[model samples]
Target: MNLQRTQTAQAPPAPRPGPVLAALAAAQFTVMLATSIVNVAIPQIRAGVGLSEGGTTWVVNAYGLAFGALLLAGGRAGDLLGRRRVLIAGLGLFAAASLGAGLAVSPETLIAARAAQGLGAATIAPAALALTMDLFPSGPRRGRALGVWGAVSAGGGAGGVLLGGALTQAWGWPWIFHSVAFGSVLVLVAVAALVPPSAGRAAGKFDLLGTATVTVALTCLVWGLTTARGTGWTDARVLGALLGAAVLLGAFVVIELRRPNALLPPQLFTTGRVAAGNLLMALLGSVWIGLFFFLPLYQQQVLGMGPLTTGVGQLPLAAANIIGASLAPRVSRRIGATATVSAALLTTAAGLLWLSRISADGSYLGQVLGPTALIGLGLSFAFFQLTALAVDGVPPQDTGLAGGLVNTTRQVGGAIGLAALATLAGSVTAHASTHRTHLEALTAGYRTAFMVCAATMAVAALLAVPLTRRKGRADGSRTPTAADPTTLPRQGRATRRTPAA
Candidate 1:
């Protein structure tokens, strides 16, 4: 009895809920805010910079390409340099870049600045998430923190369009960047004042070679895919870029296998949970990203909705996202993360199927609102749960890398999925246009895309079934608690014990 009491007393305390969680969520919000914030301001940016329609696209792609490609390096940097230090450095870079973008006088200057902003975002995002995990001891505390994180992340994406529209119409396009810069400043201050310091740097040299290989490979792949959206996939440049990416990626694999200190440690892939979680994230990203990208096109081109109205129309999705995120922890506690995710994917797929039935003349009230809400809610359920699962049993030292992998899968998946789905939709539309009216062709294309999205979600659901069986059957078959020894800081085997989730 005395031994038992002593052991219980020595156990680490549960992480108390606090303001640090809010600051971390704010950091995530600011990082994601930049992603879609510039979308609605495109017309104004083009007019100001005297950009051609094609050139304006670079404004968005520049940031995405840089951000998506550099994420692994950034996460590893945080692990080596100290997450807090790297986070501060990242925020500084983001602020400077946003300021430059706001004050830019030419398209070249703006695009360059956007790319710099992406670099900063890549640096900040993984650090923020890793820090959140460190601060919130796992279990309900971690779940709640993740709930807020998911809400803000999704909210930022949804709100960007609305905020951009309002700022562009009322203030100016530059104000969009200006506003984000201001918010970032506030978040930085909160982080510095509120969040605790990260652990000292891990014992490893910076993997510069690995970083270069992976970053260049990802950039090439993304560039090829994005370029193919406009140019044919068979274009010589696109083909060359894709081939180069494949070769570089192969080199990166070889380098990681051989290197003593690699950017992404081989141990990360050893866990089936991490691997499967990332795969599921990719599929979820593909469906949702495709939906978000094309829905606006359908609205503006097919239904003739204005930018402001379209932004407003997305309000349901935003609200439902918050609702679902808030509830995911409770649901996962009862049913397990794997089951929650599987159910949510099926729900989202059902919603996507419902949406596929929309006509060219579909009204927001009749066709768009219900399905959007459903998708948003379903996505929210899976988003945070998958995030937790990806790093569930990882060593504390690998947290940033785990975060980076999760986000990387989602971003890359979204980019590739959107490009492929859009290409398919375009082909169908063009072929159908030959025999059908313009509206009918457009509707058919959108419907086909929606159906494809539904199928993708179903596949994700099927994959999630194995997640429930991975481990933790004795811990009530629920999500693993945050304080599980296997997930704690790296220590001797004697210090670690396998705990059921």
Candidate 2:
């Protein structure tokens, strides 16, 4: 039988993104904004929401768990339902959860709402990515658009810390959640008026088991880490939770690899860049956010900076990160993705190594600025290039799942990084307090952690060269101009193509 030729259905074209893509991106901004905003307000959240040290972490953990776990499923759902439908639905749910979280009177309720917010994110992010794929189909223009999109997603997260600090200092922690609610309302309205109704198609039934397994596994691991905060890493429950998480996550991998409708294709992990890119994302994500988590302590407690000042002090990193993320793609196009990433990773590593030298009296201008800017420049070049290539290896049909995997790696990496850094800092602080002041020892712990971050990024940088330009693809993966460094392997030269959705 001859295949029926059909034009893919298009969104109703508007005179600009009056209410469509803008709304989608905004909703994304809001959902992402929520996670980082609370980081700055953790203290007030504990006091107001009755969050204990361990319990307070759940406020962040719950959202991350739900968000990370269901990401693949949400992508699948978007493909089955209309991406627009899934995107809008997710936005509405996110707004509702934000309202609940803002008014939460107890720790348990706050955690619950936070988890709900993650679910909302799970629903939205993948769908938004997929929709963007549909809206901006592949080409050079698409590549530039996607580059801008990546910057918005990344830069917005860092900005959220500053905004949250401002809001928390000026008003209260609740405004953080309320802010999301207001943004969501506007996004929802825009989406309704602008996004066309879709009779969407699905690949198959929802993968509830896959989603549940991932969620439980990540939650267990995080819970174990939280438990270790008080009970020690060797605690039986902590050990069991860690082991259980390992097994469950391993099972998730096996299941996904084997399933007919897998959450992620086994093929993706087999590629050099795909696998390596994900690892880079994981390592960088964990280490990057871990710094965000603790560096504030040095500012607030050691230097006696207020919340606003602490957030401002971080501007070096935040501002550089924005510049880095935005400029990275264009840089990669010139240097070749592999070379760009490798150089950037080296820069990041060097910065981290320098970061390890920070003392209580360490000047931000010397100790912080050089490393932060270096890391920013490096991260900006590396991540966007990797993102561009992530889906390049796959077909358009699998974009949603591919996008989910890219996202999943980052989430899991950040979680692991945060826990490892926190655990190490805790041990260092415990050991040092006997001889030195508590504050002094804590600063020592921060320096030690910075050393680890530096080492981690350095290792990743070393590995990126082999990963980006392997025996397979050439450095540019195309006719390498002086501007482009990544080439494809000779054998697959015919098969390799430019960026597609």
Candidate 3:
């Protein structure tokens, strides 16, 4: 009896889910907020730092390029090192970089700081997500936790626009960076205090060669796409960058296949619906990022709203996103994940179609609010479902890699989508400028981009059909595949089995 009592007393208590979830969610929110908070302050920042137009663009692109390119490395680092350790380090770096950005007086200084922020973000995102999965065992509770994760992440993107506008209008652009710096410090403290340490997975040496090739490949690809928006697709530099990215990517694949402990295991793609899920995620991300990009421009340029009003105007969409994310797990339980995603995509496509009809004289209430709300709801639903699907059936050891891959696809897709849509819109605007007024021509271009985004969503919806037959059981629940150890009864150690092809 004494031995039993002592054993019970020695057993560790389960972690408090609420505080852990909040800290992790806050970390994700801070990373995403930094992505868009600088947009509204670009004009002020350019003047403050004496930046040229190209330098102004770099201020935004530098962050994204670094963040997107280094995601895989960061994720792998979390797995090889420790998730909590990486998270703390990332937060420290992010806080310092935000402070540097706020204090920067030169174009070069600001851009470099922005790039450092991205690197920190890349480290934070995968580690935080992987830690979330680790702490929350797969079940209904995990589902709810993921719903909150999706909601806050979507909110951060929308909220950044609003917060950026308010901060810029009230206290100038530096305050945006200052605000992020403060938030990072708070989150870092919370994480350190509340989150428990997780041990690193036992693994072989880090895949330095695989990491380098893939990182440089992604950097070149993002740089090429971003540059194409300004210099056109046929430019020599753009072509060279794209070509270099392709070669590097090809080399990375070859190296991965040869390496015993690859940075990204090729076999993981064959697990469950991982490959298809990422493909769909890429498409969803393209539409998601494009909508946010074009919608704000429409509100400001076409409707003639100032930054503050435009920021306020996005509230409906943000509210709808919260609702949609809350509803996702419940809806997926009934209709199945694939069907839920398909329906969500169709809904978003319809919303985008409605947005395509906007005119220069359109009012915010009639033209923007309803459609944007619909799009926001559908986008949140699709993102929640797709994120689950992409990470489902992944092994415990590879969870960080799974997180990194999904994020990489989304970021890369956004870069490609934004560049293509911007170019297409520019061409349409140039053509319409021959006869239409300036506002009318700009409206025409925006309309064209919306139509294209709608079509893209529709295509993704159709592609979602195959996923149902592949991943679902006859009873409509996700099939308990061999790759997911959590699905097994906790009787003994679960054997790692390769999922069906």
Question: For every model shown, what is its TM-score relative to the native structure?
Answer: 0.87, 0.87, 0.91
Q: Give lDDT tens digits, candidate 1, residues 328-364.
A: 8777776666678899999999999999998987888
Q: Could you tell which candidate, 2 or 3, scores higher by TM-score?
A: 3
Model 2: runs farther than 4 Å from truth? 1-21, 194-202, 270-272, 363-366, 470-501
| lDDT (Cα, tens digit) per residue for candidate 2, span 433-500 | 89988778988888888889889888888887777564434554333221122332332355455334
Residue 345 of model 2, lDDT score: 74
What lDDT does candidate 1 reach at residue 454?
Answer: 96
TM-score of 2: 0.87
Model 3 pairs whose backbones collide? none
Comparing 1 and 3 by TM-score, which wins? 3
Instruction: Return the TM-score for candidate 3, rounded to 2 decimals.
Output: 0.91
